[model samples]
Target: MSKVILITGATKGFGRIWAEAFLKRGDSVIAAGRNITALEDLKNKYGDLVLPIQLDVNDRKASFEAVNKAKEHFGRIDVLINNAGYGLFGAVEETSEEEARNQMETNFFGVLWLTQAVLPIMREQKSGHIIQVSSFLGLITLPVLGLYNASKFAVEGLTETLASEVKGFGINVSLVEPNGYTTDWSGESAFQTQSLSVYDPVKAGFKAAVSAPGIFGNPEATANVILKLVDNDNPPLRLLLGSFAYPAVKKVYEERLEGFEEWKLVSEEAHGA
Candidate 1:
């Protein structure tokens, strides 16, 4: 079945690939991003099937307007893909508080606001899927990408809770945690601190390494997973994409579960029966 899908940050990177993938699958997509010319180009290629709506998901007003426009176009949104997010590399002391919070605003709170905006409509219709594109860092803590990890960790928690909340309403919330895809996720898209002397030398080294392009998993492969997510009768709430991400997610789970078990007695004692 074809569905109306909306993706944010569709001007470039994996978001753009996602838009193209969905459109090829015959899904009506609301291609949203900050770049007008890019969005216009998409509009020309896919014509009416691609609704290139300009959006910066950080703005509450613009975010809501995009949702409303998508609704107006398709009558309702079948899938909402929150893929418009970025990473910043800096230590806690090295990066300004303002920079850290900005990361959260885009990766964490922007998702929250957009999810909230779409919920009521999905609920009323008794159907929809919300796909939050978090990174493998969402599950595991990265060295210099502390702020990025922190924001995605929050996204993981939020989507977990959201999944349970909308179960009865027949709305599904899916999280896609990718390792690194063929996106322009380089230093140009990143912001770093002027001073890196605050953190230890190892952290500084890690921070410096992030400025260059690392091994990137294919965006098309990731988009194929997204297509699966859309077609499934029962999609998983959490999915780790790519060979690189699968192991990382597994390690994160094992470590987290072990830590919980090791500290279980203390937690149990606190809530004495």
Candidate 2:
């Protein structure tokens, strides 16, 4: 049986690929994004199978209406892909309060609202899949990318709690953690604040590393993983898209485990005293 999938950030990257893959599987999809032209192109290419709607996921009312409209199109949606997020890369101190809030608004709150709106329908239907487009940075922290990392980390926490809570209701929550997949992430990764006083010395080197090729896995690869996830008999709670993400996460896990053991005495002493 074919499924109905609603995806955000359909203008480019994973969203677009997901849209194409779902359609190729003969499923209906509602592709939502901020770009009208891109949406139009998707519509032209996919015809009625792809319903392109312009949306900025940050708007709660718009998101609600979009979900409802998608429901009207296909009668029901089996999957919701929350992929409309932007990155802001800079030191935490270098980022303004407004910038930080913007990051959370788009990445965290936006997904929250959409999920809340859609979950009721899915619950009523007794089954659905919610896919969150998280990142490798969600697990490990990098020096200069604190602002962006913070957004994804919140996503990790949110999804972790929600997945357990919703399991009994027949809804599955899955997360995609991908390595830097040659998308517009870097260009869109805003610099909340810039100053020679802060990044002057090593700025060039940082820029070089960031702009390097093969920094991320292919977007189509991420899309294929998502497509497979949709049809999975029992999909995993989380999917790591590239080899790069696995080792990085393993390092974090081991380090945290060792650190906990090393600090066990202090922790026990504080609790006991």
Query: What C-alpha lDDT values do all the predictions have?
Result: 0.84, 0.84
- lDDT over C-alpha atoms for residue 221 of model 1: 72
lDDT of 1 by residue, 131-229 (tens): 998878887876777888899999999999999999999998899988776666754677776566656786767746544455467776777877888
> Candidate 2, which ten residues in sequence have the lowest lDDT sum?
189-198
In model 2, the Cα lDDT at residue 58 comes to 88
> What residue pairs are clashing in model 1?
none
Error of 2 at 143 (Å): 1.8
- Cα-lDDT of candidate 1: 0.84
After the best TM-score superposition of candidate 1, give how far the Cα of residue 201 lies from its true spot, in angstroms: 2.8
